[model samples]
Target: MMPNTTTLLISAGLLLARPISTLAQTTDPNVDNADTPFIQNIRPDRPGQTVTTNMLHPGQVQLETGILRFDPTDASWGTRRTLSSALLRVGFFNHIELRASQGYLHPLPGTSVFNEANPTVGPAGFTPLTVGAKFLASTNQDARSQVVLLTEMTLRTGDASFLNKAYEPAIRLLVSQQLGARYGLEANVGFRQRGFQAADTKLGQYLGTLALNGPLGGNFGFFTEAYTTWQRSTRFLPGLTSGLYWRPLPGLRLDVTAGQQFGNLGTGFTLGGGLSVRLPK
Candidate 1:
């Protein structure tokens, strides 16, 4: 006599339900706790580590190099030039950093003749050097907010006979906040002094910039910024700048930027690229 199909089906169903019965038996609080990791170790909202430096720790360093080009709208009034620079930054304390940059300037041929030159008929050759410091004033971990202050001075290092031999200084304030898990916003305001001949000496220029950063994918991110500058002279020329940044490694960064002069005093286009490498903490 062959076995009944109904009986065989019932036996198979019971076999299939054995795992469910086992799971039900293992659902006791004591057994579950014994098998699972501790709540503290598995907490989902635990805060992450912060990036910091200590006196005992080796100071962090960063090196950057870039090339910049200035294109004048009226070639007769202003000249075209290329500048190359290397910047070095070192952390002195957790909240402070020092930066130094030195560069060479090369004026393009036929771009130096000033249309309205009297005694100074053409553009001058000059090497530029700058030194600066940044200080972190405040930071909040819960809010993901920070404030920083920066100041710098730039000096001309070329022949005084050929270039404007003076120093320019600037100060800036920066505020940054994390907008979301992978997005950040930054705002900056600054003042810059231009140094030149007695007739061309100008007061400080006011500047502002807004920046945004977001993650593009795993370990990849994107950044963009827009900036505006206002000169206080009677000429009334404002400038606008925009740029993008890319990071391909933990301590490496690349930036590309373009800017144009606005208003009457001077009009020009600027193109530049920068690379930075950060040292291990």
Candidate 2:
């Protein structure tokens, strides 16, 4: 029997590395501090459209839950509310993790042009379940840079009122860079299929986001972001968002966020709050 390359690499890593805690450490400036306790330093992906590149260590699990509300300046769009938005993450390897997300979309009231545009919406329904995996593509300790690749699929497993019969796929490239010792920068680029009805033509849009985060003294931190999306046939949609997060515990984070969309047809704003917790392995 011959030893494989993977086996050799694993053996080399085991031999070169010193024994350390099973919990993972994070590069996030807000969560990584001397005063912070050691509870698998949690890096949450919530309160914003931009997802972080931090990966949980093997055997770790994290849960993020939140609620969001959106109100468009135009009445025809009606109001949108997400009663429950949740994401579950489980680390299976040093550089790989599994993720799943679900949310409930409350129906829009009254007759509106929005109903015609989205025939599958306007009733209380479960959002399509999204399952994905994130892989740490590369990292540089000296440069303080990290790159992550995320691939996901929105399965046709929700209520028909939502997007229950569509197979939508998405991929994102996430990048993080540490700025000095107190701030970090994150950027994401991706594309995904978007449409409500399964039978309707779905259009894919390219999205990009840039965010900056830093500590606000003590257990508090702040983040601000700008994001935009574009389709070949449609105009670009741009938005800005900012949020504050409180980490009372090393394994928990609470955040409140607000953002507004800029569009010629109509403008909308969103407000949301969420909490993230890293559980015991």
Candidate 3:
């Protein structure tokens, strides 16, 4: 005997209702109030907002020194080099900051051919100086989100005998979001225009970065970041960085980072550290 279609439909309906009945039993009444300010305050929609304002005050000064190495895999095309550098940065106001850096770049002797038919090999050295600024467009207090607009210009002001003097102007937009009381995420996207003799021949570069930071223990915090740059060459250079920051006082901090570079023009690892001091209003 064939089963009745009406009876079969009723049986299927009961089977679907069982899951709904179980869900209703497991649901908590407190879950409905989960959107309270107490919860939202701890997990702000933006980073650098929940933290006390004194953490990043105006009239701050920071200093950093480190070593960077660039090793080209194709020795015939480029060279391996190291740079020792120092950076000094100052915050004039809540919205503006200035930075200056200088470094000695030493290139290891390598084989290269200006003309593929003729091979040339030599050692080279140069000093590079770079100055830049970062501007904050929207502060953490803003209703929308934390947004920063940054513009920087790096110029090689030292002797150009070994390296061509050049200038790079870059603009970036940065935004951050707070995940929890101690965790935050940030991202930046930028475009750089190169200036100098070969500037006309090469296209500007595009840069993108993402980072995460959070308090670790007592007064220390951890940070990690990944960045990539796209230039005229089809190949892209990428870098990864990990760092820790220590805050001894309300407006002072020390940070150290280590990372490696990867791609056609970048090779090897880098270690760096910096100190920042912020003044009260």
- Candidates in order have lDDT scores of 0.57, 0.76, 0.58
Greater-lDDT candidate between 2 and 3: 2
Q: Which of the predicted structures, 1 or 2, would earn the higher TM-score when compared with the native?
A: 2
lDDT (10s digit) by residue, model 1, range 1-281: 24698888889989979998888766633343322212101110000011111111128777777788876444532466676777777768666778787766555565553344544444445456778887777642123466778788887665343454568887888776654445666777877776644433356677777766556665445555555666655554555555565666656667677777666554467788877676762
lDDT comparing candidate 2 with the true structure = 0.76
Query: 1-281, model 2: which lDDT tens digit per residue?
Result: 25698899889888766443223334344444433332234678887889988777778899999988876444533556556789999988667989999988665655332244666435456777999999888743123577899999988777665423677788999998767665779999998874545433346878899999888888898989999987768888899999999988878899999998789632468889999998763
Candidate 2 backbone collisions, by pair: none
Q: Estimate the TM-score of every prediction.
A: 0.63, 0.75, 0.62
Report model 1's TM-score to 2 decimal places: 0.63
Off by over 4 Å in 1: 1-58, 73-79, 109-126, 139-143, 159-162, 194-202, 218-220, 234-240
Sort every candidate by lDDT, greatest first. Answer: 2, 3, 1
List clash counts for every candidate, in order: 0, 0, 0
- Model 3: ten consecutive residues of lowest lDDT: 44-53
User: Which wins on TM-score, candidate 1 or candidate 3?
Assistant: 1
Query: Candidate 3: where is the Cα deviation over 4 Å?
Result: 1-57, 69-81, 106-126, 139-144, 196-202, 273-281
| Candidate 1, run of 10 with poorest lDDT | 40-49
- Could you give the candidate ranking by TM-score, starting with the highest? 2, 1, 3
- The sequence of per-residue lDDT tens digits that candidate 3 reaches over residues 250-274 is 4456777777878656665666665
